[model samples]
Target chain A: MENLLDKKQSIIESALELVHANGFHGCPVSQVAKNAGVAAGTIYTYFENKEDLIVGIYDYVAEKITSYIAERDDDSLEFENRFFNYWRNFTEFYEQHPAIHGFYDQFLNSPFNSEKVQNRPNMWHEWAHMFFQSGMDEGAIRATNPVILSILVNTNITSTVRIKKNFKTKLAKTNVNLDEISQLIWAGIKTA
Target chain B: MENLLDKKQSIIESALELVHANGFHGCPVSQVAKNAGVAAGTIYTYFENKEDLIVGIYDYVAEKITSYIAERDDDSLEFENRFFNYWRNFTEFYEQHPAIHGFYDQFLNSPFNSEKVQNRPNMWHEWAHMFFQSGMDEGAIRATNPVILSILVNTNITSTVRIKKNFKTKLAKTNVNLDEISQLIWAGIKTA
Candidate 1:
């Protein structure tokens, strides 16, 4: 069972790399299987079809990020500290797995990401909603829809990573200040 | 000359729709020509190749957006008013031309948006940089990188549009509050 799981993961990773390099249509299931060093039939054993595999990749990355942040979350910390901590972990995760950015951008824009798929329960979004809601309840953040706040925070993190990735060399000279970004977001959401 | 210009514009519009519906690779030059009611050879007359055509689309959309905002921009207004006006124009543009969002998301993630391409002069970014820098100079906003400010503002706008587009039916019932978003952004960038 462990071996089977490992193979499934390997296929997802391979597909992710391919999709990142080439858009979804550019990468075929057969190519993904070849890249993963598995038989074409093996891919079907794991995923019902290409769409299923794409969603699997989404779940894989989403779980990886949410779990990483959830594990390090300190509920005892004040709302501001907790916000910055979440920002740091989120930025670090993306920095380490830059390929996920491309995959996500492509996935979000693709037809494969239908309204049905988006409405499905997403771990990261759920965590964000809970965190923001807690902040509002504690009167740490402004009184508004938690979903809006979550969107603000999540988009900030993703956009920061994207800018950093796109202008890596230019930014190396004058470092992309993560603290400034965190502060800006904190200011945006905090009670004013 | 006017007829020739219209033909070029029509080709670009058709290509944008095709690329938005189908990812870049899925839409070939031949299909674009057919959709535009022009011969395959005619597309080559205006654009050197598929890549050139893609860049042309970027320039076309970028100009369309920048000019729209520029025409309505009242430089005499206070910075806050100007900022909100810019936000309103930006949001309206996206609302009217939702196809641009999918095309941009795909283009940015694809190799089509290389560093070389990104470095090319963009009217929209140039306008944004100047606006933010002026805000900082007048002490209307925080003293930090204008690029950072622009990224925050731009990302917020794009993310808001994306969320609204993805959750149109749901958002219609809830009404994604533009005022709330603008206020959040204003609080983030304004001088304390």
Candidate 2:
């Protein structure tokens, strides 16, 4: 059982690397197997197919990202502090593991993103919604749909990370202060 | 000369319609010609190939969107009103012509997005930047990098339009006030 799990884990890691480097169509199951150092058939033993492999990678990356943020989260803190921690953790994870973000970008654009993919309830999102609800209750966040507020705040974080990644030199040259960004986003969503 | 321009315009319009419906790969030159009611060779006369056609479509859409916003723009207006007008124009354009937005979405994800495409030196962007600079100079906007502020505002517009298009039911269900969304975004970037 341990050996089976190891093989599955290796296959997933290999998929993430290959899919990140090359897109979904670029990294076929054959390439994933070769990179994983297992027989091409071995990939099938783990994932049903290439699409399945990609889905598995998505789940893995999502969990890694959410768990990292969750660990940094402290329920006892003020909503603002907790949100900052979440944002910081998310940005740091993307900064350190760009491959995960790369795969995620590709996955979002890929054909695999169906209703099933879109509506797949996520624990992280639930946690975020709960946090936003509490903020709304406390009259700290906008009374507008909590979902929209969360999306706006989330976009700020993602946008910051994207600029930091894609325009590293330009971002550095501009001397953008990351800390100020979260505050700006908060200003946008907080109640008047 | 007039006839040639009309044929070319028809081909370009047909390409946009088909490509937006079926994606770049799904709509070949032959199909565009068929939709345009022109000869297959006629498409070649106007565009060198499929990629060129897609580029032409993008340029056409960009001009349409920018011109629409520019026509409504008044330099005499306050920056806040001007920015709101820009936001409303952009969203209305996308909402009315979702196929254009669809094609744009696919084009962005396609391999055709080269540095040349990325740095096309859009006049619309220059106008936006100048407006942002003025806002910053006048102390109406946040002192943060104007680019970041512009991106945040632009993302809010795009995000709203996307949700409005893709989740019309949910959007209506939630009674999301589109006007309020721009205000929320502006709140993020506006100074005291």
Candidate 3:
């Protein structure tokens, strides 16, 4: 029984590693199984097919990312601190495993869509919508439809992370300030 | 010589149709030549190879998009109307040809690097930046870096178009009044 659970976790971790190294389409099931130190049949026992494996990796990554994002809880901290914390957490996780950044980059597009991908909505997004609402109510953000605002903000974060990961130099050429960029972004949405 | 130019233009148009229908990588030279209704050798006459052909198409698309963006001189109109006119032109052109949009969508992340693609910067970007800067200077837009702000604004527009193209039915659920959405985006960037 313990073996079954271990194997299940192993499969997900292996899929993440493999998919991140090779792109979503480039990685294959056989390679994942081999890297996991399990037989190809063992992978089949855990996942139905390649699509299932990829989606499972996405779910696992999403869950892991959300946990990191939601972990920052300082009610006393200004919305700015909490907000920057989210970006910091986001950048830190991907920084730790640059490959995971690659994984997210290659698979997040809808071109790689599947039923599991469709159904397992990004848990982090829900928390973000709540954060935007709180910002609005707290007069930290403007009163407007939070949907577009949240989507646009998150897209920028994704864009920043992507651009940062791709930057080859040590120079401070990247545009966004880790701390101040948050203020600049909210400056538009802040009270009149 | 004029007849040669017509044939070359026809070949490029045909290549665009095929590459957009398939993908830059998925389509083959033989297929492009066949689709262009020219002998395989005739393709070599105008372009060096597949890479050259792809870059040529990209340049043509960029010129067309940027030229359209550059020609908007409706300074007599209010900011709102001016913004809408620009959006209308951009989106209409984007909608006219899925292939052009596809080219941008596919390459936005990792464009095929060529001397031509590298050297050929988007002139439309300059005009758009100046437009945004003008708005900022007139106290119409929030004081942010004009270039980055334009990138952010363009990100939303292109991403929305990509979403609509990719998930036709799902986006309908967003209840997005595009005009309102466009206004909202402009409003977010604009000074109150």
Error of 3 at A32 (Å): 3.6
True contacts kept of 3: 0.04
lDDT of 2 by residue, A41-106 (tens): 988777787667778888787778778887888878877787778788888998899888777654
DockQ-wise, the better of 1 and 3 is: 1
User: Candidate 3, residues B1-192: lDDT per residue as tens digits?
Assistant: 269988888788888877666555456778877877888899889999876887778777877887776676587777667777877778877877777887666555533532346546667667787887777677776676665666666766776676566556554454444445466567556666
Alpha-carbon error at B164 in model 1, in Å?
3.0
lDDT string, candidate 1, B137-183, tens digits = 77888776677677767777887887777666665454335457788
- Tens-digit lDDT string for candidate 1 (A86-136): 999988988898778778766766777776887899998898889888988
Candidate 2 regions with alpha-carbon error over 4 angstroms: A39-41, A109-111, A137-139, A175-178, B1-53, B109-111, B137-139, B175-178
Q: What is the DockQ score, from 0 to 1, of model 2?
A: 0.34
* Model 2: residue B170 alpha-carbon error in angstroms: 3.0
**Under CAPRI classification, how is model 2 graded?**
acceptable
* iRMSD of all candidate structures: 3.4, 3.4, 5.1
Residue ranges of candidate 3 with Cα displaced over 4 Å: A1-22, A38-41, A75-81, A114-116, A119-122, A133-147, A168-180, A190-192, B1-60, B73-92, B95-99, B110-153, B160-192
Candidate closest to the true structure, highest DockQ: 1
Off by over 4 Å in 1: A171-176, B25-30, B171-176
Candidate 3: lDDT of A173? 51
Query: For residues A1-192, what per-residue lDDT tens digits would candidate 3 score against the true structure?
Result: 268878877878878777665455445778777778888888888888876777777777777877777786565787766777766777787788676676766565434544456555668667777777787788876675566566556665666565455443543453434344444555555665
